[model samples]
Target: MKRTIRLAASIAGLAGTIVLAGPPTTIINFDTYPDGSAVQPTDAFTTQYSTVGVEFNGPGPSGNSCSISPPNHAYAKRIVASFVDPCTGVASVTSYAGTAQDSCWVPGEGIDMFAYDRDGNQIGHEFNAGGGHFTAFSFPQPVIARLDMYCILQGIDNLAFIAPVPVLRGDLNCDGAVTSSDVGPFVLALIDPSGYAGAFPSCDIRHADMNCDRRVDGLDIQGYIDAIFPP
Candidate 1:
């Protein structure tokens, strides 16, 4: 089914707080397989970059039809999921992040499903599975070009990746609004680039640099604060 999911609320701190929205649920059904064995699904998707294919955790049950569902009641810039033999092994899907390595993910180990951006950043992840349930992941910003999944000791059936929604430019904290809360993430970006970028992959540095000074420092802090919360 063709649909779109947008973020209605801002994400929490670097800890990751999925802000659910009231957008339509998008579904990527992989039920069009040829009921056979295949290393990767032939269902290639056309993205901004070159086309990409769906990757499985390993050479599992040839070809199987499955579906991926995004977070329920969550406002996400982008969402992705992999359909595999639930709790069997690690199943995953890969998609195109973008040309630039400006993607990031919330870090977690031993997750049932996980996503990494073009820059090799773990944008999202989930742990454990209850049967062949639909395990999904979300990204703060839309910089996900390639998505990959794993479960530890299982195989995957199929993979599906969704399109990106819209996002406010300077909403660093992703609280649906750019207010004082953004200051924490903005400052984090300035002190620890890697940590900040990885935690809030969607928070573009350029947007955080309110004064357009090409840097996220104390200098831009004031401008950012004023711009979002103007007097």
Candidate 2:
């Protein structure tokens, strides 16, 4: 079943602050896959879930294996496991472009989960002493790029995450609003795309396309000015 969660975020613009709804939430229960399905070869697995914007990687640097298993707990209908040896395996789930938030999972064994941001900084961590329960991990913002699970015996199910919010046009600063604050970044995006990116790592410079002609050029100046000072 698909679920849509609406989170109101305050967006401050030249017009003032306004409430904007967040993007939908995606839940992967692994029920669609047949029992005992292989989840290895990270690239292939990622392509399968490309529409949902997530990737699964596993077995750590040792190059073990991971697979889907039949239900063994009350928390999930199916689970993914990476237990080549006791406490010697690692599995990871990464959101495309580092745009996922509020990741949760159900574990079948004791596991240590670590959450990282887009820049590879550790943002959150959780350790479940035992299995067969629901565990949720949250970070300071919706910038979670990856999640790693180190396990003694791993079985994960019912993985869920909040998708990234859509970029507001002309909101080059990525503050969820189009305002005067975006002018500087917008200029940078047109003159030096890489510089704009470095200045606002989490932002997509394409948002500077105020005229919406699919290009960030001088033509967008008027449109951006209009957004800041609408008639």
- Give the best candidate by lDDT: 2
Candidate 2 residue-wise lDDT, 1-231, digit = tens:
122222222223422421233333455544342233543423123223433444454222112123222322112122122111011111223332211111223444455666676567876767654434445555445556666655545445455565443346777887878778888888889899988889999776667766544567898889888888998
For model 2, give the 10-residue run with minimal summed lDDT.
82-91
List pairs with backbone clashes in candidate 2: 87-152
lDDT, residue 61, model 2: 15
lDDT of 1 by residue, 100-216 (tens): 011112233222545665566777655534333445444444455444544333223224344333234466766678777777787787788888879887655555656543456
Error (Å) of candidate 1 at residue 44 is: 11
**Candidate 1 to native Cα RMSD, angstroms:** 16.5
Error of 2 at 225 (Å): 7.7
